[model samples]
Target: MAEIYRVAVHYGNDNGFVEYNLETKTIKVDLAHDEKRREAEEYLAKEHTIAVAQDGIRDFKDQKVNAAQDVESFKLALTRMWEAIDLHVDWSRPA
Candidate 1:
């Protein structure tokens, strides 16, 4: 038997819920309350993408600015940027 975890998430003017099955490693989204579910989904997806991109950009900028005169620090900063990119890609994948 698999364990299922349920979570309710609210954003903007829309309300939605998500269910995760641990054993199968799958997630299901339920947007039952919203009349415009498709539009709301699209809007939320776009907002999430934009937010992730902004965070990555901000992190990269901060890392570069703080790395000033240290070669090792700059290399570490680059590594952080690459890691952020990988994370963003993973996060944006469709369920």
Candidate 2:
């Protein structure tokens, strides 16, 4: 059996859950029983995204910024810092 990745997006009175079958590259969505839940879930999802972005920013600030002697060295250091930040984040969504 192939592994499945499940993502649940909650709304006010209901929820919409999505399942991705990695092996088959198939997607399935299970929506909430009522419309209210959808709204709540959407709001919560937005909030979660914001929080994740904030956390990512914080993590990025903690990375070491190397002192470079010239423009080329500075660019290299900046690239390395960004790469480090990327590795530090376990991105559930874009952050």
Question: All predictions: root-mean-square deviation over Cα?
Answer: 14.2, 15.3
Candidate 1 segments exceeding 4 Å error: 33-95
> For model 1, how does the per-residue alpha-carbon lDDT over 1-95 read when each residue is reduced to its tens digit?
87765545433444555444566544444765554444433332231211122355455232222222233332232233323322111122232
Model 2 lDDT, residue 58, Cα: 58
lDDT: worst 10-residue window of model 1:
44-53
Off by over 4 Å in 2: 33-95
> lDDT of candidate 2?
0.36
TM-score of 1: 0.32
